[model samples]
Target: MNPNTTVALPQRGPAEHDRREQIIKAANEHFRHYGYSKTSVAELGKSIGVSSAYIYKFFESKQAIGEAVCAQYLGHIDATLFAIADNGQSATSRLRNVFKSLMKKGLELFFEERKLHDIAAVAAANRWCAATNHRAALYGIIERIIVEGREAGEFERKTPLDEVCMAILSAMTPFSHPLMLEQKTPEELEERVVAITNLVLRSLAC
Candidate 1:
């Protein structure tokens, strides 16, 4: 090795792939413990016995790490909703269960991991592409259920599909909204969510 020579770093590959997952996993744990704002790249690197620069080779910034964690979490939630949509249950049953499942998981995510909630909220407000696209896919699930209900004579088709999807989401806000969730009592929240869900369903009935 020449005194002034530096070797070029290897480009990212499968070897780097596992380390990247490790960083994301560690970041998730750190965010849960320390919150997103307080969780530093330096701390994450230290936790994994790497330098902050090395972590950057995997993720560009602290926010990037936070986004990765949020992505993973949201992906699981989406998968849950997607699975519910695919079940053999009636459209009404699927819709009802979607609300039930989302309410249960949303509360857990909001209360149990406040930091993760904040990260997700910011990601949406900032118009992160993944957030928008994932949300669109989620909306498609709801719309499909609505369309199914209409075809089966279980629901009215007066409203446009997009409008119905929007309305459904608005109705779900109480249970699914991440921010401002702490303002309501758990008992009241549950009651309100159930009432609103029923109201939305009834409005669509044939």
Candidate 2:
């Protein structure tokens, strides 16, 4: 799925919205326990005290439910990163904070639970809209930091802004990307986060 693509959702009344939330909540729990690939819409509906047909009214297919759950999960991280980006810190400090916060949250949310991690891994591998959008938002945050740093004379301006942003993101991907986060132990991830964040900062230095 393209990160920038938008799906137009039909407008729902308050009751409809509440019902959809209920379904999503139950699916999240089920997926967390049994994993996305193993769980079925019929099973999720039964758990939520609804019929499989009724569940389909809210979500077109099991993949739609999975996407919704994954989106909700990533929404939390998006909020955390956005807050750090706008916290009025120096660009250097904000950039470092962003990387560290992302790595920490990625591990705590994804790696701590293997089943939930699988959902993320699948979303990433399949290029689900949830994962793509999360990545796009992260790039925006990084670009914003670079712009601020350039304005404050803390980052080099000779390089194109987008190029620098992409370079930093590429360097930090091992720690921030879902599939790569589990490639190392938590202790090892932390060490790499520090090393990569500091190295990126050095490269950005004016």
What are the runs in model 2 whose C-alpha is more than 4 Å off? Answer: 1-16
Give the per-residue Cα lDDT of candidate 2 at 60. Answer: 76
Best candidate, lDDT-wise? 2
Give the local distance difference test score of model 2.
Answer: 0.81
TM-score of each: 0.84, 0.90
lDDT by residue (1-206, candidate 1, tens digit) is 21112222223334358788888889889888888888888898898899998987877677767667777787788799989988978999999888888878777878787778887777667755445555665677788799888888999888887788888876776666566465687788888878888898888887
Question: Residue 170 in candidate 1 has what lDDT?
Answer: 69
Q: Write one digit per residue (lDDT tens) for candidate 2, span 1-206.
A: 43223443332333358779988899899988898888998899899799998887777788778888888778888889989999999999999898889988888877566787788888888877787778777878888888988999999999987788778867768866788987898889889888988888888887
lDDT of each: 0.76, 0.81
Q: Best TM-score goes to which candidate? A: 2
Evaluated at residue 184, the lDDT of candidate 1 is: 88
